[model samples]
Target: MAAYTGPGRDTLSDVLDWAVVRGGAPSVAVQVQDGDGTWFDAAGTADAATGEARAPGERLHLGGISQAYTAATVLSLEAEGRLSLDDTVERWLPGALAGNGYDGSRVTVRHLLSHTSGLFSTGMALEVQRRYGTRAAFREHRYDVWRREDVLRLAVSEPPAGAPGERFWYSTGGYAFAAAIVEAATGNSFESEVDRAVVRPLGLTHTFVRHRADPGYWGPHPRLHSKMFFRDGVRPEDVTPDNWPSLLEDPALPPLDTTKANTSWAWGAANVVAPLDELIVFMDALITGDLLPEAQHRAMWATESTKGAHWLAHTAYGLGVYELTLSDGRTLRGCTGASTGAHALVLGTPDGRRTLAAHVANDYSGFPVFDRLLEAEFGAPGFAYDR
Candidate 1:
């Protein structure tokens, strides 16, 4: 890894340039806001075949960052007195988690939001990986549709990971349950709830929650490419038009087209899509207490230690966001998302004065690139770039 430094050079541009050089992805899009001002930049080709440069406002799959919206909606429902965070899942949808030795009564809305519900993630099931996890399988069934109930059932059918709240376990299935609770309590679709609670209120015109049945809903966006590993080695593959599901199982497959895959399988957990700029706005609002009442907002940041979670290092899992403690003793509150060929990250101070939101048109392996960018952006004095 090389560090970029020179007279009159921009830090954001240099960081993105270094990411590309380090093979973070074939293309990257980023937005940053500080006391100085705001900036947006893109690098590499979005469509490898056509050699099109990545655009600034191109929409990309939000991945697990969608959890933030889902969590916020749940909190909003709690604020309205429609539900309580401590309410059991069975209280909202009876018998939804009765089988597979699972007890919804033992799980609460808070547990689901915090990923402490002990639910086994259907997204991590072996069968799911074989059927829709690889690039080849993704191409075979890019348009496969799934219902919320069916997906939830598949998740619960798996064995429980542990007792509810025993320890921290990141589970997409928990968020699925949380979304179902939202629908049941509000008597409206989860998508509709998100629109009313977050999108319309924020004037976010480009953000949307995609459903599995909507196959023809390809709006204007950049071509998504995957930095997939093949027998030959890692290479960039244009996965636009649909194939995100491929990376769900085995992310090491050869980069294949995932831009057109049905994302319903990731519904409620990782199905939202938005441009990088809107993502920053959303994060700012979220961290600034604009989305929830004062107490609820405070509760949202009450984080649980993820020391042994084997997921994120030196981090804490909040209601739906993550609080990452940098090596420099500074902390950032935001979320990061990855789905197949798309990866995104947004982090800022509690006051919302400084923020950074970035997206890479690649898969899981791009995370290290994001780590380096964060170090460059917020590293403390005497920090060394050890790569």
Candidate 2:
């Protein structure tokens, strides 16, 4: 009920200053915009061995922010009359997703965009990798696939969960199904569609489709560590590296790069990678109507978010964007991404009315530093800050 009335929320001036004072080495690159204007800061190290503090203009892989980009592209296609939000997935991918497990005919594009399709998570799909025993099998089977539908044939197995338009369940598999529809309707790879529809329109230079095994594009990503020890109130590494760590301890992560396929990325689900700056620019533009027509813009942002007790502050998802209400009563529309050791997030107030901050770190976020730094900048209630 109380707003953050912190002493100096106006200037997270103490944020980086404290790090410098404590001799704490926090290498971070942030592009922020208060109501006034934009500012860029890169004070973190890109690589310890290289002593590369994040440079002023370097490209880092933006994880799930790609979802927003996906939405923009889909809406752009709608403008071109190439697709319809009301259309059903069955219309696009006939034999692939018709009246069997789901009322694919009734499941419109809107459902997927709003995350209301009640689709199950994509963890089942990842299980298919087990079929390929040798590492070389993973390379040939996982990486070489171009069509998402083909992967769906092998990977996707989520029978419809809720009704056609019932409750909400966060699932990238649904988005990937949407991507399959886009491809079926347009006859082009989802990568090509996004490149033309969103990236080119916004002039996002550093963004690209991570459709293939391009380590150069992925850049440097740390191994992922998680909260295996949930009850310890301690980091998971303390409970001894979890199963994943044990699996990937030796050569570390088993080089998922052997194959060109980023199946984990799925279709329109996650196969996007961009620099942090480009992500902010894209979000700012999308919110300000630099991307969509007025009506389409309203449709995308105004979609209903039927979230429950989990994330009470705010829980809304559009074609690819999520609107999160921070503790300060300002809604920050953004997304979070995690893959192995790579993690990222981009959050900011609409139109840069007050503030914007993005974090991209190579390790898992349960380390507690993330939420701490986030609160330090975007304070919680009773902080007596400018908000």
lDDT of each: 0.76, 0.57
Q: Write the per-residue lDDT of candidate 1 for residues 16-117, one digit (tens) a residue.
A: 777677665777877777666666676777787888887666777788999999998899889999999999999998999888789989999999999889
Q: TM-score for all predictions?
A: 0.88, 0.74
- Please tell me which predicted candidate would have the highest lDDT against the true structure: 1
Q: CA shift at 321, candidate 1, in angstroms? A: 0.3
Error of 2 at 234 (Å): 22
Query: Please, what are the lDDT tens digits per residue for candidate 2 over residues 150-174?
Result: 5555323646656767866556667
Candidate 2 has its poorest 10 consecutive residues by lDDT at 223-232
Q: Mark the 10 consecutive residues where model 1 has the least summed lDDT.
A: 232-241
